[model samples]
Target chain A: METVDLKSAGFGSNKVIEWGIRTFGKIVTRLLLQADVVALTIPKYVELLRREYGAQNVLLAPHGSFEDNAVMPSFEQGAGPIKIMTFGKFGTYKRVETLIEAFAQLQAPEHKRPALELVIAGTDSPNAAGYLAQMAQRYAHVPNVRYTGYVSESDVPVIFGESSVVVFPYTSTTGSSGVLHQAGDYGKAAVLPNIGDFAEVIREEGYTGEFFQPNDVDSMAQAIARVIDNPANRKAIGMQNYRAARGLPMEEVVDWYMLHFETLLDEYANRKGKIGLAKA
Target chain B: MQIIEEITPEKLTLRLSGRFDAHETPQVRQKFTEHAPKNALIDLSGVTFLDSAALSTLVQAMKNCRERGGELTLANMPQPVRIIFELTRLDKAFNIVNAPDAP
Candidate 1:
């Protein structure tokens, strides 16, 4: 959850329920002990949770990208052609149907529209094969749409390299997305909804974030168009994203976690020392 | 980068799209020097960024054009590009104007 979501919950029924639950938990007293430190993927939620729980033992550890930094493949180039792709599992939360519907409705010349390739990449499973079949049938008439049912870990970088833009049409999510970091690693601009930590990731990645209304096809199309139309902005934003990703490489994140671990251990040791002295 | 060129009896106007940086400055410089136009107007509204190298090339082109008793002016500068000029005080040195008069 974003800071606003946690902060905006009113002190009415929701707060009443929360208070009631806290009272019940305190009365029951299953456990009063807390973890030595709390780790959360999204920084905003970490702060809100810390304040709510009145505990400062919280660590903000944003997710890291893949350790392998092999040079990515070249993006679609030259004038008159553009390619937009999305990578992830086929799930209800992804809202990928919105992207397809918008692509079908986009008003452009056949020659030009064909320039826009929509690649929905994911490994098929029992959960989504039926939904994927429906989408394929629905857009059977549309051109330049490629659906790679399953992509291996080795091929993820290659797929990212071939595209100019990555669309994250998520309708709902609990935490930050690794996809944002993955796309950033390739210097690709992400068309994401302005919700939760999506916006924060975009901001941290500088010029790579393009936002649309959640679950709106027209809004997603417009957002994608904004990046496609301006070749220079698109390239510049991609480079900016690359620079941002470089700052938080895998090794750096590991080092940060190690440091946080040390802080926790020291705090624990000091507490033990005080208790021992008190007992004497 | 895309360069939109126009050759009228009076002068030459080149509208540059994308980034005007070191990577593109040479091409831009060549466009200005290949044929010396009496009055040069480079439309920059479409440009998203302009680095110091680009700034230097523009200054050089302006100097050359003036040597021939003409001026090299930039018009329709995007805000981000315009801020570079203002911050460097190049806005005073160069013939920078609104977009309407640029094209």
Candidate 2:
């Protein structure tokens, strides 16, 4: 099985580095295309690979969610600081400054902001080191803003459990989002940009979310406000997400893959036997 | 990290200790590949910390084992190390158990 989550050939401000990345990406893409069957998490990637790279055997393997754990707090029990959390590797495409700014904007009297805490979970992208630190320094005065550095797997439930709403502060997409799947698994309403893979996944996967234009702080603030302001709306979307996550559990996806592999193996054996018979 | 291997007719268990980070992943990968047990149990009780590189190594090893009609089960995980799996939701992908006394 091959994943088509290609690293961007064009990011950062360095021309030489960008060219090198582009070169490496081409090599990796060539190698990936050589696979008997290439599995892509995003449907768009499958189309792109087939159309752009002339890859014939691309398969759309949707990102799978785990079975529902009791770790998530019940929707009714979602009280406290009204935590608006975003979990991902920060900087580059998945920057948090926009979310932080939007969270700050959501605090305005005009928006009738509720008691909220902006929780930034996970560390900086490997290419963008010290990014979270810079963001922290930049928005140091923003009250109730908490930065959780490199959250471990176990802490995920607790962190997600505490959140009132999950936000995706991504400026762009990099394949199907595990964080989005995690948010759905944990039964949290999402607020995200209505663009690229985010739009595609929401449409394909039956995830309901409050969407705002990318990089628009006001739009983001208002979108987030819509959910946090109404418990009923939040619960409805969260419930839908929970159902969607249950619909395609990772175990079922793996079983599907095993079936496909079995077919491939059978065909391979038949081909080998035919070759042997011809030689005889 | 130290990997103590115990191979029985039923399965192969590897008891690991210390930080399972990027630095130690190469050796871990090599050891797992060398053993290539069909039914494998990795006892992570003694593991203090885990990094992304180590996680990737285990994932690749799990896939390789699964391809060979075997499975990888994580056993006796410490809370800290377990959290890493939970955060990535990898705990679901892997068969995890707390059966400490299993022979």
Candidate 3:
């Protein structure tokens, strides 16, 4: 089972419902212990599972950068407005209120910078059916906020490529972030919350970015400003991230999985041979 | 890309230089496997860049060496090339020795 942090799933606020969800999660984890190997995307979870549940079969299989054909644009060439974007399923833990509010704050008359655009790309989470629509209505007065509903696979590159900085307006992280990897693949600087799995990914994956305190508009705005105010720093961070992504492409990750499966096969064959000898 | 090889009965050391990327990987893999030495050492003093495809090739070579009851050791890794191994956390998997800096 790939690791999932149930606490971040936002099951419910009710005490009884939270308790029941926790129980269900524990049962699921227990079932996972019976599997041949429980793969965890985050490195910290490998130790956590082994200590908490005494899960011996747990192994760390880190998330890989998605295969992309997006030609990395020269950061120096862009003359358009600095577009700040947050992509992926929104609402629940991945809230965008802080980001939108921060963008509104960043666009205030007092802060002097180039023209800015806020692109909230992608749809709402299943649990958050009308979250984006509600956000669009709530922040209707905020200028230049475009909600590109359901970004197509072909357009994923275009959305990421055009953006100067990618923001993660998450209340909490549920798992290893695919969006972050996408940001790295596209050579875009990230403004992320300095918490939990985000920290772990930075430490283990060598992805450097501007960090803000979760749920704080001023902090988020300041973090975004840090990247926007300086083009050299943005390009440097983006280049470092691109190099990091190039270091661990998905093909290398697949090879690691294949090798692990081969090891498991060898173990199984030995066990089968021992059982056959005992039966004879 | 340049690969200088030194082969002995027990060990094979291949010194790689230039950009060790996808373009150079096939030749490196061929040189590393041709000898099939139990113990191998990859000297990366002259390598300017190490891409993911090259990393995968090294990983395969390491696996092959281990399966033969020996180990593949990395030596004289330059800082930039070494960062790739460190960032990917592959530094912990292979036996890396900080040999004296290349002259």
Share of native interface contacts recovered by each model? 0.00, 0.00, 0.06
Ranking by DockQ, best first?
Answer: 3, 2, 1
Report the lDDT tens digits of candidate 1 across residue range A137-241. Answer: 877887778899888888887778778788887766557677776787887877778775677655533435678888788898888887877777687777766
Q: Which candidate has the highest TM-score of all?
A: 3
Whole-model lDDT values for every prediction: 0.68, 0.77, 0.81
Candidate 2, DockQ score (0 to 1): 0.02
**TM-score-sorted candidate list, best first:** 3, 2, 1
Q: Write down the RMSD of all candidates, one decimal each.
A: 16.8, 15.5, 6.4
Q: Could you give the candidate ranking by lDDT, starting with the highest?
A: 3, 2, 1
TM-score for all models, in order of appearance? 0.60, 0.69, 0.79
* TM-score between model 1 and native: 0.60
Residue runs of model 1 more than 4 Å from their true location after superposition:
A1-33, A72-81, A110-114, A124-129, A205-207, B1-103
DockQ for all models: 0.01, 0.02, 0.14
Model 3: per-residue Cα lDDT over A1-280, one tens digit each: 2344444555666769877877888898999889987777775777778788988777766577786444665565266888999999988888888898999999998888779999999999897799899999999999999999999999998898899999999877866788988888888898999988898886666687999999899999999998999888899888877765655677667876676676678779999999999999
Top lDDT model: 3
Q: Over the stretch B1-103, how does candidate 1's per-residue lDDT look in tens digits?
A: 7899887866788889997765677787787778787789999978987654466567667767877899888998888887656444456457788864563
What 10-residue stretch in candidate 3 chain B is worst by lDDT?
Answer: B84-93
lDDT at position A165, candidate 3: 92
